[model samples]
Target: MQSTSHSAVLGRRKEPHTIIIARGDAVRHFTIRPWVATLLVCCVAVIAAGYLLATTYLVLRDDLIGASVAWQARMQQAYEDRIATLRSQIDRITSRQLLDQQLMEQKVNELIERQTALTERQNVIAPIVERVNTAPTGEESERIEKKPQLGTVSPDQSGFKASQIAALWKTRTESLNKTPAEKADLAFSTITKSLRHVEDDQLKRLESLADDAYQTADKISQALASAGLVIDVDYDKANVGGPLIEIDKSQVFDTRVRELNAAFRMLDTVKDQARSLPVANPAPGRPVSSSFGVRRDPIIGTAALHSGMDFRTGTGTPIRATASGTVVSAGWSGGYGRMVEVEHGQGFTTRYAHMSEILVVPGEKIERGMIVGKTGSSGRSTGPHLHYEVRKNGTALDPLRFITAGRQIQSYL
Candidate 1:
């Protein structure tokens, strides 16, 4: 706390100061007060430091600016690289989505084609099914109907949409939170499985249809055999022609088609033969007076050799021919009055004896059931009756046999 004067302190610092400079051949000396010398030295030191600092700033300005610009460029490049990586990921996802869409569309198209083919097959087989059902009920009909049911799908149900499938896939993927590629792969697998199921069902239906066709053909063959006719069919004969490319290449289907063809051909041949064969009763709804065999003749009253059957009828009753044939003889004969004879094909012939009047002449064409004469007891008969005889190559046969055959075949025809 001692008080000191400002002038006294200032007076004490005013002390003498000295400086000297020497060159090679010259020497110089200078003297000054202590306060002045200190002020001068401080001023000179401040100016030198300022100049040095200004020179250093000038020298480093370009380098600092370049470094700042390079740092900014590096930051921008890093950002660009991040953006490119994100873009590549997006591209991959987009490509996978497109591929999945294409595959789904292809599966849908395949399902549609299979459905169309099944519909066509049904159409072709419907008529045959109806025909088989119309036959007489028995074991054969039961066998034909006892087949596996075919699985059917409507057009609307079979036409699966890509958008709908995609929606379903998206829903599942969202629930599982799977990656885009994983979702696409799972969706494709599901679609493929569904298509395979549909195709398998169609194939099974086709196989069933083929089996039904084969069964029908077999029945037809048996029916033809019952008619006493043989059908010789060439299975290798090609009745159908088309391009080499076939839509259906199944061996089972091909075999069934061939069987059906042969069966139909056999039926046609049997029908032709039935038309020409002699299988009609000459006297319908009439009682037989005598059977075809050795019997006592009423006129001779003895066990005479009887070669024909006789039907009891009133005089002038219509007599019809038993089969289609050409007239071989007509007019009167010794024991048979107003007799007529017909020569049918296949070594078959028929005779009508003891008729009231002969309506056919020699070499005249006649059909089965045609009115050929009138029934009467003529030369050697005691009562009104008809005499009918069937012969094969000039040998006598029982007329009753032919009539029985006609009765048996009537239902089938």
Candidate 2:
């Protein structure tokens, strides 16, 4: 009996528990031991915890993705802004470079214009200078030539120098700064200064030339005065008026040009007057036999006033008028046979007497060196000789003096 009771207790302890449920007219039953039930509860807890962990992992992954996308967008925007700023800077630099180029072009054009003006002025003045250098003033010719040593700076050379300076300035400006505006300003300033210097040099050269011309004209005037000739210039009637225009700021150049013109005009007037003077030799290459003044008369053999010079020439030798004039007498006169008288203007007259024949008529115009008569001893002479007389307002004067003055003036011409 005791063995039987212990077996039953062991069986009961190992026996599986049974559970039943009934709902909605359906019934179900399940039986499990303590170890199986514990396993089932553990499985349900593990499955629930897996579901919660999966949900949390999905939410966290989406949040991390959003944050990463937003960070990437910010980085892209920053890069674009940086690029735009760089482009703006480049544009500003380009515009400045263009402006600098334009300014350089303008400066070059101005330099060209100045060179042209200077060249024109030089051309106009060169001939006047040459005339001055060539003028002859008897003993003073040598001194006048040596008076003014005019040194001229060629306009071409000046322009070339200016170009060189501009090139050097450009090179230096380029080296100074990276900014285009600064470089342009520096170049402009340098060119302006160089141009001013060139202008000053040109002005000085022109003024010197003008001074030389004035001096030459003055010397010529003095020579004329010494020869008893005067140039009558009417300043009030010069007709120099003109409409007022913009005066050149370079006054020196304009003033020099005007002075040169005036000097040249004066020289021309003097030359013309000298040409019209009755001072030519009447008998060229002929020896004088008798001088004018109180001398022994060849015919009378007595001291008497020899009012004319005598040239010993054979008959039929050509006699020429000493000056251009109108013939007033072309026939024989008392003590003169076949005589010809010419009335030159300016209170001057010439007479040729003792001629073989008269080739000119009374009231006829005669030119200098024209055939007026032939040389012969027709009246008041002892042999074949010709008499020439020069008178100033009907007063007899020495023809030799007038001939000498003519020679001197001719040298200048």
Q: What's the C-alpha lDDT at position 213 in model 1?
A: 46
User: What lDDT score is found at residue 295 in candidate 2?
Assistant: 91
TM-score per candidate = 0.53, 0.62
lDDT of 2 by residue, 1-413 (tens): 98789888776446688888888889888898898999999999999999889888897988888889989989988998899999998888788668767777777788778767767766765675576566556644665454442334355645557549988778877667656556666666766666666567656655655555455455555565665656564442476788878766866677866766775576567655655556677788889998889997766679899888888889899998877889999988878877999998888788999998889999998887899988887876678778999887898888776677667666555
* lDDT tens per residue, model 1, 262-354: 555554555445445556777788899899888887776899888989998899899888778899999888788779989887787888989
Candidate 2, pairs of clashing residues: none
lDDT of each: 0.70, 0.73
Candidate 2 ranges with C-alpha deviation above 4 Å: 1-85, 115-224, 230-254
Give me the candidate number with maximum TM-score: 2
